[model samples]
Target: MKRFHVHVVVPRLDESVRFYSSMFGAEPSVLKDDYAKWMLEDPRMNFAISARGGEVGVNHLGFQVDSDEELTALREQVVAGSVVVQDQPGAQCCYANSNKYWAQDPAGVPWETYHTLGGIPMFGADSRESAAPDAGGACCAPVTSIPAVIEKKVGCC
Candidate 1:
């Protein structure tokens, strides 16, 4: 099975959590000082929000798969389309450990495809040491001036 993933960067975490909790009709399954996540079954979605400093809007979109096989299958499809994919195996972000692939769309929207392996204590580790030059502080998407293209760098969620 796969769950659709949506991560948004908000200006205020508490206020956003209240709004989303009411809208979703459930509290977050995972809540932190700066992040919250709802593993919603009705829509089969992994909805997350963070206040870690970025453009205050939709941060990235992705899919969460159940198994490595599914992730590989998705990756194959994305690669076939000639999309530049960056693979991060055992990435720690969003209070979870995951194996993920990051890419960008035609309109410069970031996309992530990942399979969660387990949980982590913190939001994420600093990725500057391993990230590409263009990869910004955010963990999910690579910061790029050019639309529809990006390099691999891990930072935030």
Candidate 2:
């Protein structure tokens, strides 16, 4: 099964953890000095957070690749279609050195291609933003409808 992942940037780790731990009825699987990851089994999502300098909101979204081959295939697909590709391998990101590629969809939301290699503090430890690829745009899709269909179908029955 494919699991959807969402990374968030929170100002206070303790508060965020409290909220999620209550909402999900379990503590995070991994806790770090400036990060936390909840490997929730019910919904099968890797919800994580970091100390990025930003307003409290989504940091990024990602798809888990089972192996190096899948990562390579996804990279090739993006390269053939998209205008930009951001590749960062085994550096520290969200406290893990992961093998991954990054790209922006029509929206500017950054999509990451990664396989965790080891524990680290940051990704691309040496290359500063100046050396990194330009962020294409906003990052990802915008909600086009309100009162979304799923909301209508889902209710306390």
Which candidate has the highest lDDT of all?
Answer: 1
Candidate 2, residue 141: how far the Cα is off, in Å: 20
For model 1, the run of ten residues with the poorest summed lDDT: 146-155
What is the model-wide C-alpha lDDT for candidate 2? 0.57
Residue 88 displacement (Å), model 1: 0.9
Q: Which ten residues in a row have the lowest lDDT in candidate 2?
A: 148-157
Best by TM-score: 1
TM-score of each: 0.85, 0.71
Report the C-alpha lDDT of model 2 over 105-130, residue by residue, as the tens digit: 56556566666666654422434322
- lDDT (Cα, 0-100) at 19 in candidate 2: 92
**What lDDT is obtained when candidate 1 is compared to the true structure?**
0.77
lDDT of the candidates, in the order given: 0.77, 0.57
